[model samples]
Target: MRSFPVRLPSGTRYWTVLDEDLAVVAEADAFLRHVRFGRDQAELTTRTYAGHIALFLRWCARTGRDWRTAAEELGLFVVWLRYGTKEATGADRPSTEAGLVLAGPGAEAVRKPARIENVLTGVRQFLLHGITEKAVPSQVLALLYEVADDRDLPPEARGEGMSYRMKARHRVQVPRAPRDRATDAEIVALFLACRCARDRFIVLLLARGGLRRGAAAGLRRQDVHFMPDSTALGCHVAGSHLHVVRRENPNGAWAKRQPPGSGQPVPVDVLVVRAYDQYVLERMERPHARDSDFVLVNPQELTDLHLRFEERGGSSTPLGRPTAS
Candidate 1:
C-alpha cells in the first residue's frame, strides 16, 4: 500500500491511500478527505495521516488480520513498530537470499517511542472515523480507551464536580529532551557562509525573526513594513514588522494557525531590516524578479542550493517550481 497525492479540478491537493492493486482504499480516502476538507486541515496534515493509515492497513493485510481485530491486539503492533525491520514489517520486499551478516541482539530498535505514539494517534483517529461511518464495531472503542474520573485533577481543572474523561489505552512514554537553540557563533557562521543576499536574509529571518521556513518563504512584498511608522501604507502597526497572514500560497507554504485574540504582527530588529534592504537591492538586479509580488523569488540556481541544504540536514524553504518575475 502507498500514500497517493491527488489534485482536483479546482487545484486543491490532498493525499489518499492506495491498496496493493493501486486502487484507492475507499475507507481511507473518505477519512482523509474529511480531514482535509471537513476539518479544514492543512494539505500536509492529510499527507501525514494518509501515510500512517496506509502503514496500518498494509500491516493488517500482510498479517492476514482484519483491521477491527487488529485494533484489539494493538500491543503486538506496538512491538512490531519498535523492533520490526523494514522487510519484516512489509515496508520493503522480502528477500529470499541469505544475508552475509545477521542482525544480533545488539541491533537497535526500528522506531523511537515518540514515532510509535504518533502512528497510534493516527490509527486511533482512523478507527474512530470508521465507527462514525458505521463500518467499525462500537465494541472496539472499549479496547482503545478507558474511562477516568477527574478525582486526581487540580482544583481549577476539576470544574466543581467529578467529571470523567476517556483516556487512550495504548500510549508510549516518550522522554522529554531540552530544546536546542543555535548559538550566536553558529548564527554568524551561517550568515557569513551564505553566497548571496537572499540566502543571508533567509538565514537571519529563521534565526532572529522566529519565522518558520514556510512562513518566511510565503511572505509577500506588501506584508513587510520596515519604516518606523507606516500610516501612509494603511498599516496601524507601530514598528518595523511583518504580517503573517494565513492564506493559500502558490508555493504551498502555510503559516501555522495563530491563537485567538493574538493577531499582532511579528516585529523585526534593525539588523533584519538592513538584511532585507540588502536582499531587496540584490533582487532588483535580477530582471526576472521585477514582476513578482512575493518577497522571495526562486531562480534555477537557488533550486540547486535547496537540494544541497536539504542534504546537509537543513530544510528547504521553497516548495514550488522556480518562478521568473
Candidate 2:
C-alpha cells in the first residue's frame, strides 16, 4: 500500500514495501541489497526478487507467524497465492480491507501459472539466502521440502515435469500448451502490418537471425557488414551479416547472457539486407537523423522546415518483436 523508495545504479528508483506500514523485513532487505549492489544484478532482477519476498513477509505478518518458524504455513500460502482465501476457510482475515489481495474476486487481477511459479521461485531464493546466513532453522527447511504423493498430484501436475526429489509440496499445477508452427497466412499478415523498411528489417532480424530485441537494438553500423570483400574491416563473410555484442547503450538496450569478448555473427537473408540498405540510404540520411553509432534510430521532425530535426536511438521505446498469430 505504501512504498519506500530504493534507487538503482541505472538511476531508476523502485519502492520496497510489503504493505502500507510494513517495509520489507531486515533479513529480506539484506538479501535484496546483496543481490542488487553486491552481485551487480540488473534492475529488473532486483525488483522481482524484492516484490515476491515482500509478499511472503506481508502474509507472515498478517498470520501472526515468524517467517523463519512458519514453513508449514507455505502450504496455505500457495492456495492464497493462486485462489485467495475462502469465507469457509478458518484463516485470519486481513485487519484492513484496503490491502492488496494476492488472488480472489477482491484481487485487482489474476496471475498465470508461470507468473505464480516465478513468485514461488523468488520466495525459495529468499529462504535459501536465509539458510546460507544460518538464520533459518533446519527443521523449517525440511518441512518446506516435504513432497506429496504422485496420487495426490492433480492431473496437470502428474506428468514428467515434476521433480522426483523435491516432490509436490509447494508447486502449482500449470497448464502447458502445445507448440504450433506459424501458418503462411499468419506470416504474411505480420509483414503486411509493418509500416516501414526499418520495421521490416527488425522483424526479419528477430525471426530469421534469431536475435533478441535487446541484441537488435544494441547493433551498431560497424557491426553490419554488407560487403563480401570490404577494404574496411577486412573480413569476408560472403554475405551480409551482423555481429551481436554486449554493450550498454544510451537507449537502455543490452544483450542477455553475453560473454566478455568476441561477439556472435549472424548472416542475414538477401531481403533483410535490402531492407537494411533502404533504411540506411533513404531513411537514415534524412535531416532529422542523429550522429549516433546505434543502427536503429527514430526521427522526430521540427515544425519549421528551417529548424533542425531530432533523431535518437530506440532506447526509450523498446522495439518489440512482431507476434505471428
Candidate 3:
C-alpha cells in the first residue's frame, strides 16, 4: 500500500491510502477526508496519518491477518514495527536474513521509540474513527484502551473527583532529550558560509527573527516593513518588522495558526533588516524572484526554499529546527 495525494476542486489537498492494485482504500480515504475537511487539519497532517495507516494496512496484508484481527494482537505489530526491515513490505524481498553479518556499533534501530509512538498514535486514532463510523467492532476498543478513574490524579486534574478517562493500552516509553539549539558561534559560521545574500538572509531570518520555516517561506514582500515609522505605507505597527500570516501557499509552506489577540507583526533586528536589504538587491537580479510576491523565492525553481534548505541539511542539528520565539 502507498499514500497518495489528492487535490480537490477547491485546491485543498489531502492524502489517502492505495492498495497494490492502485485502488483507493475506501475506509482509509473516508477517515483521511474526515481528518482533512471535517476536523479542519493541515494537509500535511493528513499525509502523515495516511502514511501511518498505510504501514498498518501493509503489515496486516503481509501477515494475512484482517485489520480487526491485527488490532487484537497489536503487541506483535509493535515488535515488528521496531525491528521490521524496509524490504518486509515488498513481496519480492525476504523479511529475514539467513546469517547475521556484524555491522559497526554505530547502527541504530530501524525505528526510534518516539517514531513508533507516533505510528501507534495514528493507528489508534484510525481504529477509533472506524469504530465511531460503525465499520469496526466495538469490542476492539477494549483492546486499545482501558477505563480508569482519576483517583491517583493531582488536585487540579481531579476536578470534582471520581471522573474517569480511557487510557491507551499501547504506548512506547521515550527518553527525554535536551532541546538542541544553535550557538552564537555556529549561527555566525552558517551566515559566513553562505555564498549569496539570499542565503545569508535566510540564516538570519531563522536564527535572529525567530521565524518558523513555514512562516519565513510564506512571507510576502508586502509583509516586511523595514521603515522605522510606516504610517505612509498604511501599516500601523512601527519599527522594522515582518508579518507572519497564515495562507495557502502553492509551495506547501504553511504558517502555524495564531492565537486570539496575537496577530501583531514580529519585530526584526538591524542585522535581519540589513540582510534583507542585501537580499533584495540580489533577488532583483532574478526576474522570476523579483516578480514573485513571496519574500523567499527560488531564483532557479518554484520549489519551497525552506524545504530545499532542510533537504540540504541547512536546518540540521547544531542549527536545530527554527521555532517562533
User: CA shift at 216, candidate 3, in angstroms?
Assistant: 1.5
Predictions ranked by TM-score, top down?
Answer: 1, 3, 2
Query: Could you tell me the lDDT of residue 160 within candidate 1?
Result: 61
RMSD of each: 7.0, 7.8, 8.8
Best by TM-score: 1
Give the clash count for each candidate: 0, 1, 0
RMSD after Cα superposition, model 2: 7.8
Tens digits of lDDT, candidate 2, 208-254 = 77788888888887888876655468655556787787764655566
Model 2, runs deviating above 4 Å = 1-19, 22-26, 36-41, 85-109, 146-168, 229-239, 288-290, 301-325
- Pick out the ten consecutive residues of candidate 3 with the lowest summed lDDT: 316-325
The model with the greatest lDDT is 1
lDDT (Cα, tens digit) per residue for candidate 1, span 1-325? 8899999998888999998888999999999999988987778899999988987887787667899757888887787678766666554544443111234788787889989999999999999999999889999998899998888677777866578988889889999899989999999998999998988898998898999987887788889999999989988889999888766677787778864442338999999999999998887765345557788886545446556657878643444335522
**Which candidate do you rate higher for TM-score, 2 or 3?**
3
Task: For residues 1-325, write the lDDT of model 3, one tens digit per residue.
Answer: 8899999898889999998888999999999999988977778999999989998998887777899657888887777777665766433324446111223566556789999999999999999999999989999999999998888677878867478999888888999999999999999999999998988999999999999888888888788899899889888887988888877777777777775442548999999999999988887764334446778766555234445656787742222222211
- lDDT (C-alpha) at residue 307 in model 2: 34
